[model samples]
Target: MIPEPIPEPRDAESEAQPLDAYSQAVSAVARELTPRVASLRVRQRGREGSGSAVTFTADGFLLTNAHVVGGARGGQAAFADGTTTSFNVVGTDPLSDLAVVRADGDTPGPVTLGDSDGLVVGQLVVAVGNPLGLAGSVTAGVVSALGRSLPTRSGNAVRVIEDVIQTDAALNPGNSGGALADSRGHVVGINTAVAGIGLGLAVPINSTSRRIIGALMRDGRVRRAFLGLVANPVPVPAALRERLGQRDALRVADVVPASPAARAGLRRGDLVLTAGGVPVSQAQSLQRLMFAEAIGRPLQITVLRNGAMVDVIAEPTELDAEHA
Candidate 1:
């Protein structure tokens, strides 16, 4: 047999290079956050169920989905370190699908909250939680969409969780109430729903949600003011933009009969430019202004009607089960 040609000297430069950037980022996040996630076993109607929760405070305050604990007051939280603690529901806001629970013992350090406002589509995100009762589970994906609305109802109160984060991470039923963290391990959203294969939804952790969390911790409920107007985002005309300084506005799609908007003389096709001196571009902007403090208060609404800017004073009514 012919002698094999002398193998060329192995070149180190030609060696396969490892691309571990993605892995490193995800692993770092998982390492930091896995400890703060908890597997919750809740008892409801004589049946035991499991869900995930994130410890948002060092003293054992946890944030979870209201639907997960649905009508239950107490549960057990198991952490990654095999420690378990009894937790009691502090409050629940079905409209936001968020609930706060206080655990009996110490917990891992609270996660740092990140601003969801800065999130962009295609940003890498990591989901950490207990899924299908598998505690400390982790998944990685990109934010596929943003500014989504999740409609919810509690009794007769119809509400929408606006600006929800949509990701491509695989979410299971137990993933509800878990953390949807960024590459830096900051919690940007709370995992809420599994829409379809590779599709997940989270409640964005922004100013509005921060307020909701504070309310749940303090008052055990969130008080909201209702303006009975169906609106859609629309661009302000060039002429209107120069006067209002806003490029986008909410166009009144339908004014509820005898409701606040109707009472205030708001009509169909009215382009809402501002509410209470704040720019009204999307529904969430108005929702942010409709806190407990705004209830029963005269809200100055500026709308473009027939090419003229008109101010309408509408007193918001407290949103209740009987009238949402």
Candidate 2:
């Protein structure tokens, strides 16, 4: 009893000390995003599924995952404010794992979308979702990594969703399509998957994703240009690196027969320096250009072949969904 000294009485200031800067930031984000995120109950072919979604537009439009509403024509959305509404699927892009839906009733104001391209590793992030059917669940974590690729398949076509954000925030099955907000409460990523116990992944909100979302909202589908080729990033020659001011270039690993790259005389072992006047260092650099606007458009490419710079013009074709 003598060893257990009397403890000092806690004051108001001491009681408030537990809410530190990190706690305050996370709490603020939860307060801001909880109302905008909704718990979804979707019905597809008589099968019921549950997930989360976030409001991203003023007129009751919400953003979610393609897999969340798979084959669902419409569903119910329940928000944290105890309001529920019916919503219809506007469009879905499996290749990007993104879907847009419109609510039939009033909803909360949309969250501010932030550019995920500006995110750095170890930055604080807040995740708001309805995990395990618990509405308005919030978790705090940091961005563990960026530029992670997630492979997606639609029918027989396969593609990689580029520049995905990886985080340590706890995500469950029902957390799919929820908002992964920054410390400032801006929606930077759409939580899409629980990769492992301590790992989660999100679809980043960037220029490329914005283009896909716009296409989904407007055209009910996304159209992409296809240049059939496989490439790997390789270090540019020291001399070329100095002259071109770039450290890496894409090395053509394989060229599909009769495709745009092959038609343009691009062959394996060619080092691609630029495409459409933009430096080509990674697959995403070229993938970002493969949109509807680029289909059937002349794409100028510069490559290093046998130590000589070669220029070639290629007309990309619309990617067929069946074979993309």
Candidate 3:
């Protein structure tokens, strides 16, 4: 066999790079992602805040938080080129806090989607969007934590956001549903909830969002099942371990009537052990499963009660705009 060719050495043809390369890179990414953003000037039936949504799909499709575009009887989406177009709400999923809109004009393609499950804490991340009426804004920060739970503003007590990626990424109001991109310009998370303080919150585009996106592109609504229950993490405490028969699970506060849980016989004082065979109650794990689950697919749920194990089948229903 011919001797293997010697591997080429590292080329020193590198162009001049400045120390402010970090700032430069941020600007470059902002430019690349911003042309895709269109301001969501929603004209709601009721009083709703005006915000922005970024473009993710070509063919005039855009992505935004459900609350941002929800309940809008009429609206206009404004682009950076001073061109504004009328848009219609295509889909909304409060569980995932995402909505898609289709405008009457050409839409730029969204950033490349990436694997959110591979994100690491302390990794550098950047948020690009219009914040507080400021356009073409970008902020940088590290992944503060993963697997976070925040209550819904609806207070329906039926919904609790889990697996939220916490970042000090300096996000602001208009950033909702904008692209939280990785250094390589791949989309990782959808900027969703913010503390309304200095803290920023985003939902990782786990396999779940991907499916939702595909479905929304195909249909105007996402048909997924839901468990009519108010849930909170069952934190492992020294006292609860003995009194509650702890199992690193989610404690059920309330369950919906005539829901999959009620049909499958889920009751109070029960702890959810797993969702469709994956561990439940860990904010991240629960989120990952819900995100990946197909709407209407019966879920095999493992639960613990009085130190005994039980199972239930729960199917999610379609998420509709009128539900808001």
Candidate 4:
């Protein structure tokens, strides 16, 4: 058999083109976001902690994780442009792990907030933050998954921050509250946790979070409606699934004693089909309805109990921040 001829070496520039494009994308995102992200140093109850924050408003408002500035009166923020400012904590919602602050000094223009609901798996994302106390650090990665849940608690109230973005971006100790931007440099999520090596989690920027941010900015706190029930998603019965055009419903796992759910006759093992006339499929489906508007409002809920349809009216109460 004749020996195969050797193939010519591939062109170097062509070989590196893909990597160079990726580098350019990451570089552009970093340059656009670094100046808007700040290294934060906060003191709470005489204990100091450090993290990162992102400028989200033209009038010096910044957004960060609630845990970052927990019970702190104010903090110092240092930007990548060599400018430093003092910021006062506006509000903190521990259930969502989101907080807002206003800088006492000038700040860079706010980064564009993108809809995290539009992000898809495998999409390119760039993380800009002060990881390890090093300012202006940038890391690139693809979204590994979507709709992950991060459980949170405030006093006796336990909730899940839903639709969290999961990525493989390299995050570290100081990366919390940083910007997780998309390819076009829109802030899609806020880096919140390092789940493991190469696994990072972000609180998605969506309508629900927007409401929380707005409440924080205006009221210094988030007011939530309390239903007082624990639920999980479950497959809907075949007959009802076809009729409702939905595959899943929320299964009531527990109901707090004397709570609105219990008062409204909602019980464990009930499959919730709709709340306030909207289809209920996941915990978030019910959570999204538990905002300020839902408080004190009569909510009509439909459920499947013992293979029969049951309707109940629940009047949710305003969740007390101190007791929640």
lDDT of 1 by residue, 1-324 (tens): 999899888788788576499998998999998989999999988998878999988788999988788889999998888888999999887666789999998788899989898899999999998764576689999999776666555565555555678899988768899999999999999999887788999988989989999999998888878777777777899876786678988888777566788999999999999999989887668878878898999999999999888999999888765443
Over 4 Å off, model 1: 1-19, 154-157, 228-240, 251-271, 303-313, 321-324
Name model 3 segments beyond 4 Å from true: 1-17, 46-48, 131-133, 155-158, 228-271, 278-300, 303-324
Model 2, 234-306: lDDT tens digits are 7899987888999988888777667788899999999989999999786568779888899999999999999
Q: For this target, which candidate reaches the highest TM-score against the unseen true structure?
A: 1
Instruction: Give me candidate 3's TM-score against the actual structure.
Output: 0.73
Ranking by TM-score: 1, 4, 2, 3
Candidate 2 CA-lDDT value = 0.86
Per-residue lDDT of model 4, residues 81-188, tens digit only: 788999999999876789999999999999999998788889999999975357788899999977666655556655555557889998878999999999999999
TM-score of candidate 2 on Cα atoms, chains taken together = 0.80
Query: What RMSD value applies to candidate 1?
Result: 4.7
- Candidate 1 least-lDDT 10 residues: 152-161
Per-prediction CA RMSD (Å)? 4.7, 4.4, 10.3, 5.9
> Candidate 3: lDDT of 62?
81
| Per-candidate count of clashing residue pairs (backbone under 3 Å) | 0, 0, 9, 0
TM-score list, all predictions? 0.81, 0.80, 0.73, 0.80
Q: Model 4 off-target regions past 4 Å? A: 1-18, 153-159, 228-240, 247-271, 281-284, 303-313, 322-324
How would you order the candidates by lDDT, starting with the best? Answer: 4, 2, 1, 3
Model 4 shows how many backbone clashes? 0
For residue 318, give model 2's deviation from the true position in Å: 2.2
Cα-based lDDT at residue 109, candidate 3: 67
Give the alpha carbon lDDT tens digit for every residue of 1-324 in model 3. Answer: 999999777655554466487777677777787777767778665565666777766677788777787667457777666667888888777777778888887666666777777888887778877643456767888788776655564444345555677888887777887778777667688788777566788877777677777777678666654555445566644655666455567777666665556777888767877788776656555554543344678888887788677877777554433322
